[model samples]
Target: MKEPRPDEWRAAFAREFQEQSAARFEKIGKQLQFKLARITAEPLPAELHELFKKKEKALD
Candidate 1:
């Protein structure tokens, strides 16, 4: 088989990089969700709950 052209190689590399980046981001997001769910399931300090509410309100 013939070697891939320069453009073809570049395109392949870019596609692979994007796929890997997306997978990594997805994994991180899932981990963050799991941690947040765990934290929310337990009783939190009143100060922390207030802080979280403020932060969430600011985001809205």
Candidate 2:
């Protein structure tokens, strides 16, 4: 059996990193969407709602 070259190992590592990062970002986006929707649906004081809105925007 042949061993992987350094460049091959580096390419594989980079590919894995990119896939993990994409998955992580996708999960985060879903979570943020759910949280924002829940916040919008629930009733709250004006100030707190605005605070959440700002946070949501900041995450974007």
Candidate 3:
């Protein structure tokens, strides 16, 4: 069989990279959701609450 052309190789690499990035983001999203659930189950520390308020003010 003939070897793949440069463009074909680039396309294949791009597709693989996209798939890997999507999968990684999906995993990170799930992990964040799990952590959020756990955090919500307990009382947040005062420092974190203050930090969140500061961030909110910064956003506004």
Candidate 4:
């Protein structure tokens, strides 16, 4: 078989990276949704809730 050109190899690498990144982000998003649901469902103390809000804002 012929060797893959540099550009073709790069393109393949980029496509694979994109696919993996997308899959990882999708999984993370689903997990975040589940965690958010659980957190929202359970009532939190005012102090703890305020801490969470601050932490989230910091991340943003």
TM-score of each: 0.67, 0.70, 0.70, 0.70
lDDT of 2: 0.98
Clashes in predicted model 3: 0
C-alpha local distance difference test of each model: 0.98, 0.98, 0.98, 0.98
Give Cα distance to truth, residue 43, candidate 4, Å. 2.0
Pairing residues by index, what is the TM-score of model 1? Answer: 0.67
Q: Model 3, which residues run further than 4 Å from truth?
A: 44-60
Candidate 4 deviant stretches above 4 angstroms = 46-60
Measured with C-alpha atoms, the lDDT of residue 41 in candidate 4 is 93
Residue-level lDDT of model 4, residues 1-60, one tens digit each, is 999999999999999999999999999999999999999899889999899999999999
Between prediction 1 and prediction 2, which has the larger TM-score? 2
lDDT of 4 at 6: 100
The residue pairs found clashing in candidate 2 are none
Each candidate's number of clashing pairs is: 0, 0, 0, 0
Rate residue 11 of model 3 by lDDT.
100
- Pick by TM-score: which candidate is best? 4
Across 2-46, the per-residue lDDT of candidate 1 in tens digits comes to 999999999999999999999999999999999999998999899
